[model samples]
Target chain A: MLSAEEWDILRLSLQVSMVAVLAVAPLAFACAWGLARGRHPLWVLLDGLVHLPLVLPPVVMGWLLLLAFGAQGPVGGWLAEHGISLMFRWTGAALASAVMALPLMVRAMRLSIEAVDPKLEAAARTLGAGPWQTFASISLPLAMPGVLAGMVLGFARSLGEFGATITFVSNIPGETQTLPLAIYAALQVPGQEQVVTRLALLSVALSLLALVASEVLNRRMGRSHVRD
Target chain B: MFEIDVTLRRGERTIALQCASAGGVVALCGRSGAGKTSVLDMVAGLVTPDEGRIVAAGHVLFDSAGGINLAPEQRRCGYVFQDKRLFPHKSVEANLLYGWRLIAPEQRWITPQEVYDLLGLAPLLHRRPVNLSGGEAQRVAIGRALLAGARFLLLDEPLSALDAPRRAEIMGLIERIRDSLGLPMLYVSHQRDEVERLAALVVEMD
Candidate 1:
């Protein structure tokens, strides 16, 4: 029951959030693993930086992203020299969403990694595994449930990301207008309440589906871990 | 042959131990907090000693004065933890083969079939660690260690967690492994009977 424009918004939202979660997963895993296991002195600082987006106003984060990744910004200028741009682009929206979702990803993953017994890792070491080998064989597999949960959480957060995305990419109808932005746009126009309702319902449905999927995945992983 | 002379300090506790083993099981008997496990951990390179030297299998595993400390994986010492510490995500067979896979082909003398037969693990090969009994888990842990090409084994109270019957069963299994493989072992325990039954050399600690 959605029009072509509404369909485009839904499709773009899905694409942007997917990209955001995918891009954030690996980095989040590395950070979580380090925070959970490493004894580096700078871990406190690193942790603070990772969680900054979670506590900061979304608009502030978006502004920081713009400053760092806008065309006139240092990093953005370097990227632009290589034929890349994030300013007011869908990629910029994805970047903002990813940033907003990262803390959840890292927190979930870190807790999971921490739950894995270090004694088991030591046991692996004594059984001929080096650091990397032990992590690959033991730590990573045991922490998989958390990593999956983190990804779903990140995806959900990305789906609802509005302030950072709007501030960074603005509201471009077919390019950067995600579901939330679309709903917001529909609200600004009087007598477009029907459009707003449909979009809002779609967002709720998408988020609920994600939460259900995460629960199913976590249960399956938990069962396998228990059986093993 | 194995030799260790180490001093470790953890908080206010200081554990200083000196012992040497020519062959057979060398039991480190001590009360809790007496550094029995700490000694084993030091030899396995899991815990670094403030000042010590550890030599095993004609190689210097650690020498604090000489600035030489081999990593745990480089020591070729199979350590069986008290809790078994079997990989929960892996099946019994996979856990048994965990260390064997890392050894160089020529160094891998213990075959999977031999391990399965020795530990009576064949029946439980496909089962996970969570499904196994305490005794079963320890047996798999032992098999995993032995197959890793360990020149010697460091067993930290491998039988402490089991009941009397299971303890006896594992003790019997340990006796068999000693007889069959003849690998030197450092067995940590506080039990007098275990020391009397299995150890050829006893290193008593306070």
Candidate 2:
């Protein structure tokens, strides 16, 4: 019952959220690890900075991104010299989504990682595991369920991201107009209630799917150890 | 061989210990909170001593004045913790081989099969750490340590958490390991009879 334009919106939204979650997962995990384990006073600052997106107005986050990643901005200028740019592009939309999702992902992952017994890491060390090895073999696997949950939360947040994305990338149909932006655009017109309803329903469906998928993965992760 | 002269400062307490041994099982006998586990931690390089010299397995594991302190991974010390810190996510077989597989072939002195046989761990191999009984978990913990190509062993009250029968079983296994492998061990325990039965030299710590 959806038009080709609506189909394009759905596809673009999925692509943006997927890219955002994948790109943010590793860096978010690192931030989570630092917040969980680092004792240095500087970690307090890092923790605040990482969670800044969660507390700040999304429009403000979008504005900050625009300043730092706009073509005239320093990083953007350097990237432009390298034949790359994120200004008003779908990649820019993904960047906005990623920034908005980071804090939620980090918070969930951090709690999981902190819950991991430090004694186990010490044991790994005595068994000849270096810090990196201990993290990979022990810490990461133990924290997998929460990490997965974080990713799902990030994906959901990215899918729903609107204010930052619209501010950073603008509503360019077929380029940067994702599901939320599309719904917002539809809401601006009279007799577009049909379009808004369909889009909103699709958003809820996608979120539910993500939650169910995470729950299934979580159960499987927990069962993997008790295979006997 | 082990030679340790270390001073550590805990909150509101200072622990000073000096001990030397020509190998075999050198037991550190002390009551709870007497810094026995801390001493083991220092030797394993898990904790740094405020000031000390530690020589283990012919290596200067730590020397404060000489400015030498090995990392835990480099110490080649098989530390069996009292809680039996097996990776709960891994099978017993995987836990046993976790360190064994990391060592270079040339550095490895024992085989996984031998560790399994010595500890009677073959049957428990497929089980996870959560499924193992107290004694069985301790055995797997010991086997895991032994398979890591340890230059020496550090056991911190490995028997304290088990029931009487399980404790006796593990005691027998410890004796077997001591006699057969002849690896140097820094065994920590507060029980006098256990120390007397297993230790070649008893160093009392307060």
Candidate 3:
């Protein structure tokens, strides 16, 4: 019962969010680890910078991304030489969404890491584990629930992100137009109330699905960690 | 043998300690925060002092004058936290094996079977940390360190979290490990009874 454009928006939403989560997962883990455990003077400064996107206007964020990653921008120009174009493309949408979702991901991971006792790490080190091995074998597995919760929360947030993605990548149908943009376009067309209604229902369903998935995954992970 | 000489100035209280252990349990005895944990932390390379020298079995883990400050892992000091600090997600067996994976086969001393026998972990091998009792968890913590190829074990209030009966059970196990392996240990606790029962030598702190 859905039109091709509607399907295109749904597919694009999935693609954009998946790419965003995958690309930033390792980086997010590193950032969260540094924030939770680092004891240097600049730790607070780094923490503040990581959370900047959460407080800034999404539109403003999109604009900054455009200025920095657009073809004319210095980094973008350098990247273009390597054939990596993130402007007005799917990658651009992912970048904007990842930037928007970073704060939420970091928050979830930080709490989990802080909850882990330092003594345990000392125990591992005594057993001859290097820092990286300790993290990989001990900390990461223990923090799986929080990491799952963060990734799901970020996916849900990206499904609703309007300002940043729109500003950074613009609303190009079948290219960057996600669920929110599609709904916006439907509302602008007069006598097209039916399309608007359909899109709204779809958005609610998608968001609800993400939320439900998160709860399920977190619960399952929590069960495994607690027993052992 | 392990030898440490250091002075720690915490606020106004300046605590200086000098001690050496040679393959026997040495207890750091005092009430809470009697510099008991600080001493062990320094020896384990967890904390740095203004000026100090820690030589454990000929390896200088920390020497302020020599510009040598080895990390906890490099120092080969096995630490057992108060709460056990088991990897919550892994099974008891996996948690035990976590440190083993990082160790070369030649360096690994404690076998899984030895751990299983030491703490009766065979029954709870597949269980998670949440499923473990207080006594069982501490026993796992002990086994985990042993399996990781620890040259020296640093136990910080290892049995304080348990009830009376559970503490007794774990203490018997500790005695057995001490008698069998003769491994050097720095036992930290405020309980005078625990210190007297387990340690061969006692260092009283203010």
Candidate 4:
């Protein structure tokens, strides 16, 4: 039984995680494709950059984002001039979560894209399909199972995002205080053990639900891959 | 029609080739690894030759000297590989129509109904490639290429993957396509009988 304030925290966390996953999915897909198929030296450089967040401490990632996207920072200052600001905002929380989720998403997607037979793409090309059309019709559909798995992993990562979100956007009730932050806040207060337990359970339930749903979706897509 | 003079460097071996054809079934007969498939790839724009000129159906697909190289999609060549290479995810109908919808209506010489009947594809439309037999899958692959408005076709040992009965059946189908459809083909096969039975002109390779 979550209290009204607790419910607000849950809702905000969902909103932020959902926004993060949506915002980052298409970008992550492009990055994955580049890494999987690109033969240029720059692609190797991009591979390292994409994996940086996965290896670096989340706090360092947060600090870098702050330096680049904070109000006084270069991109942030230009954005502020246009009446848009991400510092200390819920959107900033989403950006933090998205950055944290990227490497996991891209890694999953790239493996699947690489597994696609290039000969099939060649066949499509001879059948009057252009590069983009071939990717959409053949490569993308063949990679759906892995792409869905990546989204699930990304969503779970975004939902649990803490260090980066806390650093980029300070915990503010109903704004940036997601599940982990709310639990931390409750733990700091005396006699608030029950509140912490409830929030923690909710987080576990959400992650479990994502895992089960992704399993079901993957089975359906896997039928096509049974022979291959 | 095809006129090709190409040179390719493959590891230590250098493949130098020259051929001219007025079109129909021009069989490229060679032993395994003789670069028969590589020639088809060059014409399809999948593999670039070191220096070459390829003219197919009166269109110059590649001419290194003139800097004229068209992309695979622009060449309008139907390529049926040894493996058939049917899209695993799509149903037979979808796979059949995948390229058909890309061609403009006025340029579309073959209709879906005609292809379905020609290839006996109607019965397999609802099934995916994974469920299809080798012969059925090969038929769908050919139907797909035809529906794409291909000006010419390249068949790379198209019957090499089938059993004896299936081979005979598909060979018959190929004869019908050649005699009825009147489409020009650059057919590749190592089998002497297949070449003798299907090709009007046979070019030997080492």
Best by lDDT: 2
Reference interface contacts recovered per candidate: 0.82, 0.75, 0.89, 0.82
Off by over 4 Å in 4: A217-222, A226-228
For each candidate, what TM-score against the reference? 0.96, 0.95, 0.89, 0.96
lDDT of 3 by residue, A140-219 (tens): 77677778888888888888888999999999999999988888887888997888888889889988998998788667
Look at candidate 1 and tell me the lDDT of residue A24: 89
Residue-level lDDT tens digits of model 2 in B48-119: 999999999899999999999999999989999888888989988999999999888998988988888888
Per-residue lDDT of model 3, residues B61-106, tens digit only: 8888999999887776777877677877667888888777777889
TM-score: model 1, chain A: 0.94
Candidate 2 docking quality: incorrect, acceptable, medium or high: medium
Give the DockQ ranking, best first.
4, 1, 3, 2
- On DockQ, the candidate that comes out on top is 4
All DockQ scores: 0.66, 0.58, 0.60, 0.73
For candidate 4, report its TM-score.
0.96
Model 3 bad stretches (over 4 Å): A40-48, A216-228, B21-23, B163-165
I-RMSD for candidate 4: 1.6
A1-228: candidate 2 lDDT, tens digit per residue = 889989999999999999999999999999999999899999999999998999899999999998888888888888999999898799999999999999999998887788688989999998999999999999899899889988998999999999999999899999999999999999999999999999999999999998887677667555643421
